[model samples]
Target chain A: MNDPEIKRRGLMLVLSSPSGAGKTTLSRLLLADDPNITMSVSATTRKPRPGEEEGVDYYFLSTEDFGLKVNRGEFLEHAKVFDNYYGTPRGPVEEALSDGRDVLFDIDWQGTQQLMESAEDDLVRVFILPPSGQELEMRLKKRAQDPPEVVASRMAKASDEISHYTDYDYIIVNEDVDMSLARLKSILTAERLKRKRQVGLSNFVRGLQQAL
Target chain B: MNDPEIKRRGLMLVLSSPSGAGKTTLSRLLLADDPNITMSVSATTRKPRPGEEEGVDYYFLSTEDFGLKVNRGEFLEHAKVFDNYYGTPRGPVEEALSDGRDVLFDIDWQGTQQLMESAEDDLVRVFILPPSGQELEMRLKKRAQDPPEVVASRMAKASDEISHYTDYDYIIVNEDVDMSLARLKSILTAERLKRKRQVGLSNFVRGLQQAL
Candidate 1:
């Protein structure tokens, strides 16, 4: 239903959630379903895992190179997690936005806050929550990659992360993945229809008025 | 899925468009499909048409009663169109909103401005436009109730109405009815998920935190 004549600036869709809250699954689903959106590739100082490709999985960089990019102010939002530094590169996302393509960010609250500071108008922040504490613990433990002590530590971190739910524009208590995905798609659809985002609307309306 | 534990305050969905922009058709379709939203019945001084029922089609009132309601500040918005007066009663709408039921208004730009003054936070205004000036004229002429002279006058009035498109929150160029209806539903769904509209979210989050 989009009018070809009316050009729109794309929005920054940031989905933040605690670990094991189904954010990754939802993000993957949305990317596969929507043609207009692309996942944001982050630059990280962490070593790449096996089968992880450069630029596709992440922009793997040494500490010096990452520091240089940070000094150059090339990242939209950056943070240090444990001993590794990770940040979203600013150039590609800006290019996508101007060309009317959305960039999706699967980041935490701190990264979302940084994006808000830089591009408040373009950002649509949605926080995802587990149905209950018990559910969250179960999901965390079900991932057998982590031991019990790791799961306990992750739960503590999840508590801190979920505390920032009020900072988001929309909160989804993700009881079911499909329902949450539908709501996320609805948010994207509605935000695209916003009057301010349609950059060429004034010219189109002006042309209509002149024709009348 | 809606969580019963987290209550939400309803939104005021105002749809404004020119006479032949398919707003009325879209409104009817939305009302028939969505059980959660109801039309905002206005109180008017005009005599009821055949089969028009009181408190359903309209709350037909005398000029004196309408004037009294206006003087008492009972109307959320009241306006005199030609010789007759029409208004939205604040009491019923407020009751519905507090009960988590949405009210849809098929009013013009003037009435929408008044609604914005009274309930800016609650209002989600959408303005529809025809695909072109020629299409708008064709649609107006297709309605056989109006004569050619009336159609010409409506075209003039439509030009005026179309100028207010920038004042709306969302703008839809109505190329097809089904597409427009889908966009309308997305807007409602997204607005319902807004953080400010979710009234009981804080307590729900607090409960989750305590459980954690």
Candidate 2:
């Protein structure tokens, strides 16, 4: 038989950053542009914001339900923030990965660590940083979602978050949207081709030898 | 003073395969295409082949000289193949990596193991396989340098080499040259962006807070 088709185990890519660092935008762009990659929808106890859909943007769950799932080990990674619990559902992410798809995580440093510790071999973590403190403040203020004081608090938190950048597997400086996106694409493309991911390679070669 | 440009260590990528599997060709392509990657030239006691230049190809060394260097722990990795001694020099490779360049090793399985044991954190191993045994035979035969008997013997040896495929991090089937090249390029590009390799990411992000 032709060497069995090399099927790769799915990969978990964590993109971590402080609030307003453009991870969400980059994740959206990645999903839209790459068919091989799929975004991992999270489960949250937090109330849905305007125009949010259950199971699409997130698995909107009650606090009790969220707590129950967490207890059942149904989360790949989980964290508490702003008086609400948020987590990556175990089922969907596992399904997507086993099907040879790449999953993106737009999460915090804690979530990144949790997933990595649990699945170090499959996890690729990237920490994104704003180009400059001034730019970070500009981006946060531009959002118009937060008041000046809240924005300042986020800026303060950013310094703390950036301190952990070395813990990630890769880092990207979001100086320009296009450039950062390009770099991200290159990284994903290259990672997809890693030898460990190409299980079919050996069998493919065997087939070639048989044919020859 | 900013982070002193904290030079990180270099990575060692070992590409191994049976003769005629295009390991050498792929290594050359990778070296020529990537300015940041340098080939780890082996110091050999064997005489140079036609068209081979000293230093550019192998660092021609006497057997006694090679033995002395090996005794002194001068080689990062080395081996004796076919009654001739061959080994990768230590200084140049280390220097290249300290300067942020990646080094490629075109060595066999034994040398690959030594590298893994010596510099496990910095090593990425790739194995190239012929698409089929028949294809392997054809490739061996097509190399006008060898006779039919030699081709058959090489083909016999290929099976033994291929049995160790599981030890590799990535495997490539030499089905089509261009496609394989594309795959190879992707692997290198992805590896270059690995989180562990970006030594200054943390400090860089910390610096960004100034912009805020």
Candidate 3:
């Protein structure tokens, strides 16, 4: 809205929440409201769906190519599950950052960890939390009413995700969608102004010094 | 204006700038706009001005009493300059912090460094930069067309202040006052959400986990 671009490098705004905690909805609202940020398109070994575009949806990759890229450390972070590999490639993220346009990441806690390992300072992690466990279960049940054991496993997974909440830079308890989105926007606004993220900072400081 | 009370510990928002960079104006605007935050009333050995009240303006102190308090580790950070003592007390700050009421600090880089040493995690440092050296000088001249050497000394002091700009967690170039205040508000909002600052967070997390 302000559109005050001082020519700074962007951040990896990693949003991680348990499946029913409204992470996707929050991400959508953020991208819709702000033109300065863009979703980070990831590469995947799985075949693209019919409607999905190559760059728009996913950078669809062959298993061999994925493996080769992993070997070369081209991906910022990657994971292997079942028969396919999915990872955020380093190239496009770096390109977006240097252009002073932020990249939004909708990744799990493990992926967030990997990103942090690779690029610690560039990443701003915000963990989304459900208001209550009952609300979380209700949302999950609406999606699918599974057997007791399955429900137990889902709870276990949610617990696992919640355990990593402290690993994030900020936390947003999703009591209301609008409020959560507003908080996310505030976090983004604040992170953008961090001194290290401003690529033009050194030069800007130098100019100020010369005038003094 | 939105007094959404999700009780949490507050942060020490330290604002530093060179003399001509408009720190006082930004501080006054922020204080006027936000009721949830209050100025960090410092303890001083200097005499209070005519309109100033004892506790509200400053906790007026004698030289001996100030030295005793310093010895007792009561002040978070304090300094002596030209026979006058000024310090932020640890007790009052801690009380305000636990009650979810933020404290604003308008201090120089030296005071900031001392505060950082004592309460590193609780502090958020923001440095305001003037638009240009020329602008800074013009403002200084307007304040008083002092001798050339005095002007030179002021510029040198400003340069020293600017050199520590990198030491802050965030930087705001005061090109526009309203924009800078908006940015400051955003920073405060985001900082309030950090899990560590939210003392009730563990209980909040527990409640969520139990529902799952």
| Highest-scoring model, lDDT | 1
RMSD after CA superposition, every candidate: 1.7, 3.6, 2.3
Chain A TM-scores for all candidates read 0.94, 0.87, 0.93
On TM-score, the leading prediction is 1
| Candidate 1 local lDDT, A123-202, one digit each (tens) | 99999988888888888889878777888888889989998988999888899898999999999999999999989898
lDDT of 1 by residue, B103-203 (tens): 99999999999998999999999999888878887888898787778888888899999999988999999998999999999999999998898898888
Most DockQ-accurate candidate: 1
DockQ of each: 0.72, 0.48, 0.67
lDDT of each: 0.91, 0.77, 0.89
In angstroms, how far off is A117's CA in candidate 3? Answer: 1.5
lDDT of 2 by residue, B113-158 (tens): 8887777878888888876677677777888787668766777777
Q: Residue by residue across A133-203, what tens digits does model 2's lDDT show?
A: 77778787898887778878877887788777767877777767777787787677656656676656656
Pairwise DockQ winner, candidates 1 and 3: 1
| Model 2 spans > 4 angstroms off | A1-4, A47-50, A145-148, A198-212, B1-8, B48-51, B145-148, B209-212
| Model 1: residues with Cα > 4 Å off, grouped in runs | A145-147, B145-149
Candidates ranked, most accurate by DockQ first:
1, 3, 2
Candidate numbers sorted by TM-score from highest down: 1, 3, 2
